[model samples]
Target: MTTFTFHGGAGEIGGNMLLIDSPGSRFFLDFGMSFKRHGEYFSEFLQPRTSNALGDFLNLDLIPDIEGLYRNDFLSHNKMKTSEEPAFDGILISHAHLDHLGYVNLLHEKAHVYASSVTKGIAEALDELGSGSKDDFVKTTKSFSYYENKKGEISRIRNCRDPEIKYSQREYPLTVDRGEFEVGSASVQIFPVDHSIIGASGFIAHAGGRSIGYTGDFRNHGSRPELTRAFVENMASSDLDILFIEGTNIDEEKGMSETDVGNEISRLITEAEGRHVFASFPVRDTFRLLSFYTAARNAGRKLAVNFRQAFLLDKLDSNKALERGKDIIPSHDEGLSVYIKKREYGLIGEDVEEEEKARDYDKKERPYVGIDNQICWKDVRDNPGEYVLFLDNYSVQELVDIQPVEGSIYIKSQCEPFDAEMELDWGRIENWLDRFGLQVKRAHASGHMSGGEIAEVIKTIEPKLVVPMHTQRPVLFSDLCDCEVLIPEKGKSYEF
Candidate 1:
């Protein structure tokens, strides 16, 4: 018999933890941390772990211990155990998204971890770019490794229960077979799927004449839509007993396709009076970048991207349009006159030469400026006409420090969480808008499928049982499909 349990990500967005046990072995799908509420987080800083780490435990109902599930002792150094300690057989990382793979480093060294080749590359790249917090839960057993230096202070945190023990580093094969792997008595396959980020995937686990499918996070459109469709069709014919799907856009009333959203953003940029600043999540979606490129080109304004965004574009050398240098602006250009926050420049790299490369442009040409917080005020005073500011969720408030003139707009080019509980800053965004008088517009499309598209996928996959994950409204499946919607509660086991 095989049993499946939902440890986290049951009815929430983050902290996606799932446990699958078959015969003598068990494994985890994902383990992530959830953001806490506003007041709760503030109180948590005053007393770490004592007060629930910003109410994440309370909000997700995670405070109460679930019977039969292992405690998250892997999160702390003091409570860590040796390899001989009880642990899962393996962990399957579906993709490189922080929410999906965040708590992965928590696994013991003896446990195996698996991901696709492309996904592994992206994950390493993220660590190189200083985005290694996703794996903070894991400890480093060796001194010489790509991630050793960065794991310095993190290794010192005290473990909760066991004071004498030290945690081991996470160990896994560089790449795993996408087709299937045996874990105890069950077989698991990794299915590639299209999403905002490259190399995202779903999973198919089969055992005892029953099969289950898990869609990590996916979209049904864009360059890889066909691949996604094919995966769905293949799963449909596999006689699967259950399917776990993601319903990220379940509550969105009127969502546009990626192509349409791109066109709309282009229109907005075309009509803008000044230079355009676009803050985007630079992932696998080249269409969004292309849309910004087209809009800037049509408006006769240079498209300026931060060093991190530029690096993302560089990694995607596969895109012919971006590679040909159509409308994209290289990071280091002198005489380029747009000001960006200085702290953001740190993402490029630590090397002084590499940092200087962004500023090394033709001095004879028009000055294109990148500004840090201290110098941004100067750029605003000197080059107000040449700048249009684009703000992401993280740096939106920086615009206030610049205080652009009336006609300038702030374009939000990503999905804003609808659930207030899930958002990090509540009402802070509205307050910022009110103070700046900057017109705010959502010029973004999701990287996940809509209700209709998810329904189409269900029909195509045709699994014996349908389950939904990574969604707030899992009940929506009741209206879309005829299969059994197995809404497993946290730690509640389902046997096959």
Candidate 2:
């Protein structure tokens, strides 16, 4: 018997953790963070205690308590029993979205991680650019261990700053080729799928003489609808015993495509000529970024992205050939510019005293400070119509410096507020826009298949059992599909 357990994503829309136990193999699908679950205990000001390590996550049921599935440093330091060998075979990550790959660094070191090359590259870039107390994704920093100082006193080893403590790089086998790979007793195959973010994939695992198909998150309305269609066609002939599908948009009947968003943005930019335009969207959604880039090019304006997006674009361009045959816009494109916001002390450029601006920005950001395509607040303010500034709510403070002209455009190209905290943030953004006399417009597309599209996919696949996940309305699957629908309860085990 093959047992399937729902540890997180069953009753929610983002936190996805599925444990698959076969006769001789045991592994997890994805170890993601559930926004709904995390919001219950932690907020913006209140965060999980780093001193407690995994204690907060474990106690709050944010992560499963399965043995031999967590990091060694955390387990031993927290006084939890340590395992000699990793309990699970491996983790197959579908994409780089936070909801799908947030908690991967917390897993056991010996367990190999399987993901696409683009996903690995994104993880590496994020880890390199991330500050605060974040551990690395490609190479995790060792934590909570102790060592003897020169004075013969015991002291806890800090992350990577200490020369003796090295970053741990685990075995992350690239699945970009979409070839068959062995995971314990199971054989797995990967397929590229369309989603809001790049490097998204679907998986099919054959173990214990049973075939299971899992869709991490997909939509047929994005720029690459053909990718989703190919996955559906392949699954239709695979004789799948069970299908695990995302139902995020299972209650909605319609969806907008990325091309549509691009057209609307072009029209808006054309109409807002001779004035500045600013937009906000998920930075990782390279397709949406490309939409804005194309729109800016058509309107004779450069798209100015923050340092994070510029860094990510450079990384993606370096690994474009490694991706699943998708071409992303190059970071060095003439129509693209890196926006360098004034850091601490409000100092930028060479004219400022070096000593005063030394502590303003991180070393990673210093390299692009004076680059040819870089733009600062003064540059944008002097030539407002020459650039389309990309600024999210977190970066809205720059508005005070740039001071966008009246009738300037502000495009919200992401999802609407899903929770109260987000609603409050949106309200704050509105206040900023209103204060600057900016005109706000929403031109975004969702990253999931709509109810009608999902129904069509279900009918085409024709699996024996349909299991809905990554959704709040799981019961709706029964009405949408002709096959047997199992609405899994959180933390329960089901067998086929």
User: How much does candidate 1 score in TM-score?
Assistant: 0.72
Name the weakest run of 10 consecutive residues (lDDT summed) in model 2: 320-329
Q: Cα-based RMSD of the predictions, in order?
A: 7.7, 2.1
Provide the overall lDDT of each model, using Cα atoms, as 2-decimal numbers: 0.57, 0.85
Q: Taking the tens digit of each residue's C-alpha lDDT, what string does model 1 give over 372-438?
A: 3212434553454444344455666566456666665666676665655436453677677667776
Relative to the unseen true structure, what is the C-alpha lDDT of residue 253 in candidate 2, on a scale of 0 to 100?
74
Clashes of each: 20, 0
Best by lDDT: 2
Model 1 lDDT vs. the true structure? 0.57
